[model samples]
Target: MTAAKKAQGPVLTTRALNRATLERQLLLRRHTMKPADAVAHLLGLQAQNVKPPYYALAARLDGFEPEEFSALMASRELVRIVTMRSTIHTHTADDALALRGLVQPARTRELNMFRKGLAGVDLDQLVVRAKELVEERPRTLKEIREALLERWPDADPQALGIAARCSLPLVQVTPRGLWRQSGQVSLTTLTHWLGRDDGQEAVPDETVLRYLAAFGPASVKDFQTWAGLTRMREVFERLRPGLLTFRDEHGVELFDLPDAPRPDADTPAPARLLPEFDNLLLSHADRTRVVPPEYKGRTWLGNFAWSVFLVDGFLAGVWKLAEDKESSTITFETFGKLTKAQRTELDAEAVRLLEGPLGTGLPYDIRYEKVVGA
Candidate 1:
């Protein structure tokens, strides 16, 4: 049977959806939530690299200091582990332990893509040896690879090392994930980081339910896509009676918690500077709500991708900051003609951003130039 389609209440124009997303993602304005709280509320932050999220948070959270997040890792309240879509994400320690088991299947599939390099290598035995090597003490990436070569001498040791790290519930140690610093990859057991004996247990449905609680009123596909799990349609069906469903105009189903913020389509949104690869941009399948169609080619740049200006919620244009020894100037180039007043407001926001948060310390000089024939 086709799912129920409630009458469209207010057609949230693309701009309206963009604003709502910015508000929810904390990009519309800097907020005061602690790093751990912020990570928990957003489910997790995209942490492909460590420093990016620190800067990303700094841009969004008021008075955000790097140590605020670094301390969480030190306290074992938060952990840097492989979770959520089998990508590197920084999540609460409790969530890390609970969700690791749930996403293992996805991890295994991803790990296999590099398996040709591990041909004739025994993976089951490798995990045992890999765990033994790290259990005694943390080891740097090179050290781990050298030790693994003892068991699989002919195998590509680097590939072997990466596979073992992902297969096992290993957490990348800090200084590795520290803010404003660069460090070598190091391996330590997740159990060691969290200081818990229950690391081996299978995560239960409550963990999946927690994802639903935050990003819900969503379909099983959305859940699996975000969490990087599979064979979970049954899970969504099981949870169906407890969720609220609505079909978008395209007939694709969307699910969310009944009480979650599906705010009015007309809610006012402000200009935002989003970090590259912000969760707000990467979290969805349908991006029409935030990125304009014509600007897609520019947003998905060929070589140089800069942080974007989300004006009135949707991405309006691209902005870049460049500096010589004496001064820094922000340049704005829009896809279409801007009214004189709009151009003025954009220039003001750019000045505030470079000086206010980035603290470039150089003088602020802003300029606007239209794309010829645009």
Candidate 2:
């Protein structure tokens, strides 16, 4: 029976898959990657909030400083834009242009869903006018809403603004995503921000290869979930010749790049503190490899995703940070118990976080609760 299974091919257990994912995510060990380079490699960091991307790079990169990333935002080398999953992501300037076009069909579907609110509004005219408003100068959503209302006063005020977002490749300008800075979400076209007229669109076939390089051993369903697109099985089939295949323990077929790293099942993975909505947990349809089944729903609270912590490359706990004018404190609350040695390692990691990217120019401390909610 063992020989028969071997003849079929290797079956990757959950642990093996977890290690491989961590390595690709740069969570297995800290790397000395440049800010723009890392953003391009991870596809982009989930930037729903300003600090998550900074805190994320802190945990994944060696000797990372917040200013290193913030400078990229200021230079227009990296941008915060609505792209994958229809959520704001910190993407490279090139990606901001290409991916916007790649996922445009999904955005069109999103705009169509609000047609009831846009009964008389012409989407083609809306796109042209929105491009003018933002390219003239960055405009806040309130400004855009009011501008649209002038043209379509009876249209649902909120829906008009959302429709504009869905139809345009708007980017959130600097000082909003810059580290240790605050500003309202102001917008502009990617072309205006990057100072280039022509941008190459992201080839979906090429994207499959890039996705596999960073988040592979994935199924077509997993890629679809991450890209927020569908009908990708055809693409996968086309690329199958250059890929390798293996079955997950559940017999689900997984595809990976031929030379991508596939770590052994028992490889050591240190504790990692990940930002809220990190792709490591969200990029796959079946999350069991990174999120143990029992901990389902623990990392979220009524639509909010808390920053999470990993012990041995699996979701073990949730963490929160509290700050005042004088000091900052980070608290850890694990869903499962840890060994004495594990506790020691986590303590050190928490301190590493305080000293690194989170250097808020204030005194710092760490705290641990006996239970997750306590």
Candidate 3:
């Protein structure tokens, strides 16, 4: 049998996939890499909410100071922009530039979904005018939409706003994503914000390799889902000679970089706290690798994505923080029974999360709430 066939016979069990993913995600043990490096390695954190990236890096990096990430944003070395499913993410400046062009197709699809609402509006003019407004200075969505409406009063205002966002490479300005700081979501063109005169665009093959490096041994479907781009089978096929392949227990073909980390299934993974919409949960087509089926649906309550924590590298429960002037409290809601030892480890992790990355410097409490349905 060929080597590929040899590697395929043994099915990778769920726990095996779980352990391998945890190791790749830096959740098995914290690494000493710089925060920006960590962000790049993980292919950017799912950062619809500003604080998730800080919490995500803290969970994956050793001695992580929130300021390290904030500093990158402050220096424009890192940026927060809409990419990968057209959601806000904190990406290294390099990624913000390259990946944005690659995902333009996905953004165009996003605009198509609102085409009915955008009838009678000249989209070409909208893009030009939108660029003009924000390129001058960062403008709030409301401000941009109101201005667009003046020109296209018969068009759907909401659709006009979405059109601008979908058409432009808008970056959420600092203080918006800065730690412990709050500001309205403001936007400016990536070219203006980054001051890049040289033309650069997304390279799909490079993006595929990066995805594998961070969240891989994944199926093409997994990648398409994470990227919000479709018809990736051809891309994977083109790179097949340079990639390694394996099969999960369910017989799905999985792809990976030839030299990427794939730790032994028995590798130990510690407890970790993850913010709402953490990339780990959202980056896969089959989340069975990181989320047990029993606990899967619990992460979402209606439309809200709850903050969560991991025990033994698998999602154990959902978490929320309640804070007062004097103290902060973490409310952990578990889907099933956790061992006494797991609870202890989770508590310790929570404390570190609050005092360290959270930087609250206040006394805190961790409370457990039993899972209602599960």
> In order, how many clashes per candidate?
9, 0, 0
Each model's C-alpha lDDT? 0.69, 0.87, 0.87
Single out the weakest 10-residue window by summed lDDT for candidate 3.
1-10
Give candidate 2 regions above 4 Å deviation: 1-8, 370-374
Give a tens-digit lDDT track for model 1, residues 1-374: 33344323324444545555566677666789888888877777877776557756765788776777887876778777877766678878866776787778887887888898888888988888888888778887688888888778888977887788678988888777865467777778888766785644334455556665544434566667677777876765666666666655455565545565665667766665565566666566666667777777565666335566666677777676677778888777776877676776676667556666454578878876665555
Worst ten in a row by lDDT for model 1: 1-10
TM per candidate: 0.82, 0.96, 0.96
Q: Per-residue lDDT of 1-374 in model 3, one digit per residue for the tens?
A: 45447347456778877887787788888899999899889888888888889888888889998887898998888999999988999988888888888889999999999999888988999999999999888999999999999999988889999999999989999888898888889999988888984646767888899888888878899999999999998998888888888889888888888898888887778889989999899988999888888776878878689899998888888988987899999999998899999999998898888777575889988899987876
Q: What is the C-alpha lDDT profile of model 2 across 96-189, one tens digit per residue? A: 8989999988888888788899998888898888889999999999999999899999999888898889988899998999877899999988
Cα lDDT for residue 121, model 2?
Answer: 88
